[model samples]
Target: MIEWFTAVQVIVALLAGLICLVLGFIGKQPNDLTLGSIVLVELLLIAQLVVTIVAPTVGNEPSGSLAEFYIYLISALLLPVAGAFWALIERSRWSTVVLGVVGLAVAVMLYRMGQIWFVQGTP
Candidate 1:
């Protein structure tokens, strides 16, 4: 729910997505760089999870629908896992593209989550 933290997440997700997209386009297979970036993004998501858990108890409660925010958060958490698993299973450049897509998706979702937390009546 913290704006600065959400900004950080969005930036990292964007970088991850860009990196994977570039690698995929360059014909690079899924490797440590690609996988590691996804891992980094996932770590940030975990941090966001912790922040969301602690924020409410500390009086930084969301202004929008908590359920909607949580749904976005949970879905964002899943994308990287699914993308990484698919990359590992397929071991293809296209899998790298999939990871890129996942990263971008998480970024957009995080932005929406911020809206859901701070801007009421978002639809």
Candidate 2:
């Protein structure tokens, strides 16, 4: 895992999380802006997944435990994908809340990725 990529993911997730929280509070119904932001965050997660795959192949294996990395990698992509789909179907404030949780989960996953990458004998 690249520190730079994980850092970017964390930053984008934080911004998206903040936006989702505000939208969840103020919106009458979930709108495109909220949906769009959620999609963008999902895209970032996909990028991270790609990097995670390529990095190990190219000799940049992180230092974290494999189990943890696998869990984080899978969850990072799955959460937002599922949340966005659910939000699309739900069409309510709950959708925003779902996105918000997705954002938060991605951020936590990034932090986990960081710990895994840097910790001794972990990856």
Candidate whose TM-score is highest: 1
Give a tens-digit lDDT track for model 2, residues 3-49.
88788889989888778878797863567877788788888878777
Cα error of candidate 2 at position 41, Å = 1.3
Candidate 2 TM-score to native? 0.89
Off by over 4 Å in 1: 121-123
Candidate 2, residue 68: the lDDT equals 78
lDDT of each: 0.93, 0.81
Cα displacement (angstroms), candidate 2, residue 27, comes to: 3.2
Determine which window of 10 residues in candidate 1 has minimal summed lDDT: 114-123
